[model samples]
Target: MRLATVADMPRIGTLMRVSGAELFPRFYTERQAASAAIYLTEPDITLIKDGTYFVYEAGGEIVACGGWSKRNKLYTGSGSQQDDGRLLDPATEPARVRAMFVRADWTRRGLAKAILDACVKAAREEGFRSLSLMATLPGVPLYHAFGFQETRQTMVPLPDGVQLEGVEMTYELSQ
Candidate 1:
C-alpha cells in the first residue's frame, strides 16, 4: 500500500460513505448521519491538507486515510480537544492523528493498523508526545490494538437534536 495525498480525499470519503454500516450507525438518525458524513467527507476532517494526512492506497485505490492535525483551530478546536498529543505540550504537539478510516473491503487486512502506525510515527517524528483520535463506533478496536485507550466520550450535536457518540482516545509515545 502507498500513502495518499490531498487528491485522495474524495475517494476516501466515498469509500466510508458507501460502507454505510461501518460509518453511519446501523440505527438511522438523519441528523447524526448527515453531520458525521459532512465532516468526515471533507479532506481535512483530521485537518490533513492543512497539516499531516495519511492514506493507504492499493491497486490505485484509496483504501484508508488518517491525519495528524498540527494546528488546534483546524476544526474549531477539534484538533485540540480530541488530540491528547497536543495536551502534553504545544511544542510537543505538532501533529494530532484523527479521522482514521479503512475501506470496508479493506477491513481485517491490517490497513487500519498500518495507517495508524504511520500516523503515530509521523506525529513522533514531528516531536509530538502523543497522538489522539475520536474513535467511531466501529473504530475502537483498531485503535486499542495500537496502544490507544479511551480518555473521554464526546457527543456531537446534530441538526435534529440527535447526537453522534464518539470516544476520545489517545496514544502516548515513549519519547
Candidate 2:
C-alpha cells in the first residue's frame, strides 16, 4: 500500500465505483445501491492531501483504497456539515476511518484489512487511541471481523434523496 496522491484519483475512483456497484446491491435496493455508488464513493481529497489515504496496487492497477482522518469529517460527500473540517484532538476524539473501497474482483482478498491495519498503525503513531467509521451494510461484516463494535445504526442522506443505511462502529487501539 502507498499513500494516495492526486495523480491516483482516477484509478481510485474506478475502484470505488466498481466496488460499490457490485457490493451494495447485495444488501440494498437497486436505487439505493446506485445512489450509494454515486455519492458515498467520492474520493476525499483531504485524506489524500493529509497523507492518510492509501491505495493498494497489483500489476499497475489500484485494487483497493481507504484512509483514516484526524479531521472531523466522519465520511465524505455529505455537503459540508457545521463541524466537518475541524481537526480533532487526538486525546479526546477518535480518528475517522473514511472512504474505504476495493475493486469488485478483489473482495475477500484481505485488502481492506491491510488498509485498516495501516490506518490503525498510523493513527496510533499520531496518538489516537481509537478509530471510528460509518460502515455501509455490505461492509459491516468486515468491520466486525476487524474488531469494530457497532455503536448505532445510521441513515446517510444521499444527493439523490435516498437514505443509505450504515452502521456506526468504533475500534480501540491496543497500547
Candidate 3:
C-alpha cells in the first residue's frame, strides 16, 4: 500500500465504481446500488490532498483504497450532508474513516483490514481517541469484524434523490 497521489484518482475511481456496483446490489436494490455507484464512489480529493488516502496495488493496478480523515467529512454524497470540511478536535471529535473500497474480485483478501489498521495507527498517533465511519451495507460486516460498534442507521442522501442505507459506527482506539 502507498499514499495515493492525484494521478491515482482515475484508477481509484474505477475500483470504487466496480466495487460499489458489484457489491451494493447484494444488499440493496438495483436502483439504489446504481445510485451509490455514482455518488458514493466519488473521490474526496481532500484525502489525497491531506496525505491520508492509501491504495493497494497488485500487478500495477489499484485493488483497494481507504483512509482516515482529520477533517469533518464523515462520508461522501451530496453537499447538503454533514461534511463541513473543518478540522476535528482529536480530544473531542472522532476521526473519520472515509471512502473504503475494495475491488469486486478482491473481497475477503484482508485489504480493507490492512487499510483500517493503517488508519487506526495514524489516527492514534494524531491523538484521536476514537474513529467513526458511515458504512454502507456491504461494509458493515467488515467494520463489525474490525471492532467498530454500530451507533445508528443513517440515510445517505444522493444527488439523484436516492437515499442509501448506511450504518454509523464507532471504534474506540483505546480498546
Candidate 4:
C-alpha cells in the first residue's frame, strides 16, 4: 500500500464502480443500487492531495483504497466542490474515515481491515481520540467487527431524489 497520487484517480474510480456494482445488490434493490451508485465518487482529490489517501496494489493493479482525514467534510468528490476544507479539532471531533473501496475480486480478503488499521493508527498519531465514518450497508459488518459502534442510521440523498441508507459509526482510539 502507498499514498495515492493524482494520476491514480482513474483506476480508483474504476475500482469503486466495480465494487459497488458487485456488492450493493446484496442489500439494495436494483433501482436503489443504480441511484446509489451515482454517489460513489472517485478519488476525493482533497484526501489524495493531503497525503491521507492510500491504495493497495497487487501485481501492478490497485485492489483497494481508503483513508482517514482531519478535514471537517464527512465526504466529498462526486463532482462537488462545496467543501471549505476546514481542519477538525482533534480535541473534540473524531477524525473522519473517508472513502473506502475494494475491487470486486478482492472482497473478504482482509483488505478493508488492513486499510482501517492504517487509518486508525494514522488518526491516533495525529492526536485524534476517536474515528467516525458513514458506512454503507455492505460495510457495517466490517466496521462492527473492528469495534465501531453504530450511532445512527441515516438516508443519504442522492442526485436523483433517491436516498441511500447509511450507518453512522464511531470507534474510540486506544491511547
Candidate 3 TM-score, true structure as reference: 0.96
Evaluate model 1: give its TM-score.
0.76
Please, what is the whole-model Cα lDDT of each candidate in the order they appear? 0.63, 0.91, 0.92, 0.85
TM-score of each: 0.76, 0.96, 0.96, 0.93
Residue pairs with backbone atoms closer than 3 Å in model 2 (clashes): none
Clashes per candidate, residues 3 or more apart or on different chains = 1, 0, 0, 0
Model 4 error, position 41 (Å): 3.0
Better of 1 and 2 by TM-score: 2
User: 16-60, model 1: which lDDT tens digit per residue?
Assistant: 566544556553366666666655444554354455666777787
**What would the per-residue lDDT of candidate 2 be over residues 1-175, giving only the tens digit for each residue?**
8999999998888898989888989999999998898888888888999999999999999999999999999887677788888999999999999999888788899999999999999999999999999999988999999999999998988877899898999999973
Compare candidates 2 and 4 on lDDT and give the better one.
2
- Which stretches of model 2 miss by more than 4 angstroms? none
Which 10-residue window in model 3 sums to the lowest lDDT? Answer: 75-84
lDDT of 4: 0.85
Superposition error at 29 for model 3 (Å): 0.6
lDDT by residue for model 3 over 1-175, one digit each (tens)? Answer: 9999999999999999989888999999999999898889988889999989999999999999999999987888846445468999999999999999999788899999999999999999999999999999999999999999999997878889998898999999998
